[model samples]
Target: MDDGSGIAPPHIEGYEILEELGQGGMAEVYLAEQKGFGRTVALKVVRLSKYTQVDQKELCLRFEREAKIVGKFHHPNIVTVYDVGTMGNFLYMSMELLKGGELTTKIKSGRVSALEACNIVRSMCEALSAVHAKKLIHRDIKPHNILFRDDATPVLTDFGIARSVMNSGDATGLEDIPDLTEVSMIIGSKRYMSPEQSIAAPLDYRSDIFSLGVVFQEMLTGERPVNFHDPASVSNPSNNTVAWPQEALIFKPLVTKMVEMNKENRYQSIDDVIEAMDTLDNKFVNESAPLRISRIYLFIPLLFLISVAIWILSPFTTNYELTALDPNNRLIDKSSLSIYLVEGLEKIRSFKSLPVGEHKIALKVSGYRTKVIAIDFPLERNTTINLTPVSSPSVEEFYTFQDLLEKGPANSASAKEFTERYGGSVLSDLVDIWSGENAVLLNELSVAAKLNDPSAQLALSELYDRGWYVPKNSDLAQNLSKAAAEQGYAFAQFQYALILMSQMKYTKDEEEFIRLLEQAAEQDFFLAELLLGMIYANREYRSYDPEQAHRYLRRAANKGDRVALYELAQMIEEENPEEAKIYRERAIRLGFKVNQDF
Candidate 1:
């Protein structure tokens, strides 16, 4: 059956292709009827010929592993993967098909109502929470990947680039899946990428949360929260950027925390985000509830009597004023304080008056721990309580250190103070690495590597390979990387593989070199996968195998790699002009310059 794209759908057993639903970088989704089940499903098909091949075995294994990982997810908010199989050079996955349309369509229409946006985000949190529980990082969480059921319940789909977080104890089946890492071959849209994801850094559940925050903001304001011209500014977006309708004001604080550029500052867990959203939902409901005007006369009399009684007892009632103090007993800003009275479950103003009695209340301040204190009115009418600051340094301190560090080693003393304050922390370690002397840094890394720490071994490997703060030593780099690689580090394996190739030992130890590459590729290391494809496709390498070349190239091309696309197109130009034209067009669209009249 022809999918409207003019390409005939691969005939898979037990399913009849109806029409194409959509197509992404690697897969084309079609609406199909499942036999026996007598139900419609989305059949996502990835044609092997579409991407240039690198290694046939590795490509097939990666595809099957991805399917198995996603198929295990069984959440209502997550799209269901029913079955997966290969048919005639095509890998097809049967999944639940939703007709309500993509979240992108809803976002394009205009800003969604506050309630609807909250509900959608709540669903996403639940879905993502489940994925995180399984130790998987979605990597991609944008409106385009979010669909809805007929009832408008948001469902997350597309785990194409999602992978398990490192050091996962429960990520059983996901251990073997290859995750895309190279910046050039990074899959998914860049607009919604988290700050860390943009640089192809290690990711966790918080990465997905940042992307979700971007989508949530877009859904509310009809624009992304990020400043496209200065994406780094997303960490602290000003309230004035988007004119949030008065009704959506409740979402401002929650959304602000979601898109924090520093993952450490973002919501630590999906449950926390969900809880915050629930609070917003309750506040929104209470604020939006219409005032009833019935029984005006009776209500007016009752209100008058209460006002008269309160006025009579004005002298007797003690005015309760709260002052939140910092560690030094200095008063904090009133705007930073959120006071809640335990009695009557009321949220009171910071300086509001209260009745003369012992009252319990909770106080929350930005960058400080929440404190609950009980105070008796009339005895201590005005109270001051010291709020212990959180142990971690605030974002402002980080900025201060960054500015000082930029002044070079001359200002290293000032930067060292900042690092000392957060001693033994990750931030401090990073600062020490950057602000300290290169000789000291190299010595420290060497000591750690000597202790057989894989992380240190990997770091030393890169430093030695590039001659950073040390003389260039390819042999030492290879040995260090191989040490880390032997301990089952995927990135280290990739590095060692490249180092092996650079040493030109592949001519004598071709088997071992290819083994390293496959080991790394099997872990979904993008560069290793790309390298294998390139090596097999080129006659310069003894590993040249046409079938392997095509498989690896196809996988890389499907990942939006322009080089892969251009090369794959050239390889198949004579035999498969039609497919080659499609590949070439894709390359051109990606801004790959080609000579006219090929």
Candidate 2:
């Protein structure tokens, strides 16, 4: 139980408590060491003073509900829950530890740039979109609940008060809790709550949107709009106005719609908000005078010099104009050929203005193998290149799908056609990662996995690991992950290592876990590097090695992981306090958090 001073870290089986991270009214978060895995996790324990039967039952239900809610999310912007269980009066859940701290700090500091605010809102919108897709409402969408990862990615967390919008068969398992409706009503933070939320009215996903809009404004101007605080203010339809700062006016239209007095007047879905925000963000980046001016002076001179040099060299140099013909003797589109100047195979649009000697260039079209052509350039009228197309039609289709996906979100018609054409094939699942439709991806992967595709297996492994739309099955996840790992897929290796680390206790199993992580790290997988760093840095472990820890942690830090930078500082504090302080400060500027004493 938390006293005025602090709460004692609870003794949880299978985890060694390192230190207390923080505490709220209902829970205390502790930094704990997962035994055997040598992994660090933020362990949240339900903290109650003078616990009664009613209070105990309520807290436990809420705690379990949070785990279930967060567990179902397999999104990049949502926190990952590793494990959950009960120990006497304490109900503890282990989750990914985020060192970048809360969005609250940035908002409170009043130093958030307009771009930063936009990024935060965009990321949260995506997260909430995932929430709403599951027929759930976060209820709480304030800055306090939004935490950041080392990469400065905003992560939606703390789902203790989150409730599903649907009344029956909610996936969060809230139906079992008898008083959940009463507990959820009128429960969110007042300063960020919607008028309907404040009045204990039935809430929907729009309530969360209203709260997020308040958060968005706070991030820009360091204060919530007045209309949200008092229910009476928002009750008046005409008073639904926000006084945005001059610099933040670009966002006013979106925010105004988000916090509209009438839910019907607001954006219908998070997807619509995302689409609008994406357009606004792109416009701001492209058209902002200050942003354009920052590079104009340098870019203009560089571009002009290059253009002049090209024009001056045009006459003397031989122009090796090349045309490619497909297997069917049809002229291949120039855009389709990814031309490269040979020797080093450096990418170029065309072999123009080259020396009149033996010249070689490589052509790589989507459905063809990379073909290198040797040309005696001085006297040739025009070079004709013949390209061989791949035998499989699926390979060609896959490339087309890949190209469409790379350009942008594929159109619904194209996506639907691709799925219908290649429904049960490995190629479709391999390319569907960006489809943003989890249900379809799951079904497609389930079929493709049976065909023994490594990529499909890995993808399915992750889906099962998160239990996003299925029952949580660690055994199945481990098996699938292991199969993909054995095929030498780096991401699969990392994931398999994680599953093994969580379950393995034997020395041989620990060695295998480390081996898998090391394999993935060797492939420059930054997640593996981050995990290896943490594992080697754990002082509680017998295998703790500071040198190895620093090496791996530095690798991850170099990859723009702010959490790794913070951890590096913490690891070296005793040996090199001054350098440690520098690393910590660098992490702080990158939006990571350091303890007050540090």
Candidate 3:
């Protein structure tokens, strides 16, 4: 592209080059005014003069392939290709002229609100879905590749460096073809490349999903999700996981999953991405990046009627964070996610509106458990219902209400689902402990307990430990808690460790108690992390290790355990006052009222 005088080419096969837009990796984009058609078009030209004759032919093949690939797309979100031709030493292609420019321009100025960002991300997903449907991958998915129209409708552009495609998966005939990508040389922008792409590994549509995650994060936070500015380390990410801002806590889980380092962990397809986006509250997007002052002014001119119109036009629906948790309190990823409306449909793929009333909904996740609950929603905003996994049972897989009492772990997904259904009314009647000594209460607890239901066992253990309902049997409390912990219940494991570690009775061995603490800490139970941190940091404790203690403290602090953060600050106070102050401030923000004397 000529920067001065615009004299690179007066006319390229009759299309006059009015001005050079910019130079890309392999091409120079020019704003070309079509002489015959009497319209302006974005003309991209790859100069073949720099390469040898053989390489030039290969480049032409790639260029022609790009043109053919893009020509198949007729979506509203994609930039339409108009013409393709060779002009002297350059292979050129003409595309839709987007006067509003690239989306990167707006992102450079400031972040857009979450709602608008979602709208842009949604548009990108639709466009990418079209490209992916043809079994082609758009290897590059940076913000600059997305353009906007006069009305600010995002249009996905630049499908030049896409993955190579043969005429019909031709392998033997293409044996002589040179590899477009080499392990030594990384393709695509470093900042936007997925974990697989960064390693120069074979990619699928999921790579683009990761790249789009980066773009959307920038749209919300005004900066790329890179912890460090080192390119060498970035190409092979040491720990490339992005940490969402505190302001973005609502959508953090979704964003985190999108940018997952493992390709298998990412959202499978655009359909999945859209589904997750649907459940997310739009208010986060609205707050993440706000509409510009100019955009606000444009709406202001329409007056109060327009505002009312928007409010009414918007769907009267609530959002939910339908999350799945294993018994260990770990998040289950990419489960067989589905939602169904009672009495209407088996699978509700899209939700236009979920009315504010008692709605019977069934939720299922593969390999874990199926749960159905009647939620009085919009009030239960951002609902995170924890479902237990189906674990090993000695007697039978499907246990009945009576069978559940004798089973090993009443903590089965089915048992938990049953409890969720009846626990409300059953517990409602037992509001006061004095009036709760009923046959049904004891019977249900036994069923749940036999099913190895951790919550049920925990409740029973509390009763026995404090002599509330049962004969305050310390032995019974310890045994019941150990049963729950053995089944990988995080909270139960933590409490069980406490009972065993107590010098008052010491029913369990010391070694077993330490192992229980480790189990719960590994699951990131906050108190477990805090307890382990304190124990390991103290020399008087049985096992003391500063390195492991710091690790646990940092983990607890990261999880917003204020005491853990304060402890970390105290430990590092003499070593680094500034760093300690930073930790103290963070702890303070998390509602850990620090000493004013500090």
Q: lDDT: which candidate is best?
A: 2
TM-score of 3: 0.46
Question: What is the descending TM-score order?
Answer: 2, 1, 3
**Residue-by-residue lDDT tens digits, candidate 3, 1-598:** 4332335553477688788889866778899877645668989887777678998987887777667667666555787777887766778898879988887888887767665777788778878877776766788999898998776767898776776433435322223444355544568887898877777777778889989988888887776665333666446665555555566567667776888777899899876897787667445434432333335555555665454344334443334456766667777674345565543423343333444457766555533434556665444545566765533221112122323333424345545644544443222212222133555555445544543455556657766776655677887787677666755767678788888677433424656777888988777677778788887898966578898899999888786667788899998899899999999998777556545211
Best by TM-score: 2
Instruction: Give TM-scores for every candidate, taking all chains together and pairing residue i with residue i.
Output: 0.48, 0.54, 0.46
Show pairs that collide, candidate 2: none
lDDT for each residue of candidate 2 in 432-511, tens digit (9 for 90 to 100)? 54455566556545643433345667767765665645676766777787766765666678778888887777878778
Off by over 4 Å in 3: 1-7, 164-185, 227-247, 281-598
Worst 10 residues of 3 by lDDT: 392-401
Off by over 4 Å in 1: 1-6, 55-59, 180-185, 228-240, 291-598
Candidates sorted by lDDT, descending order? 2, 1, 3
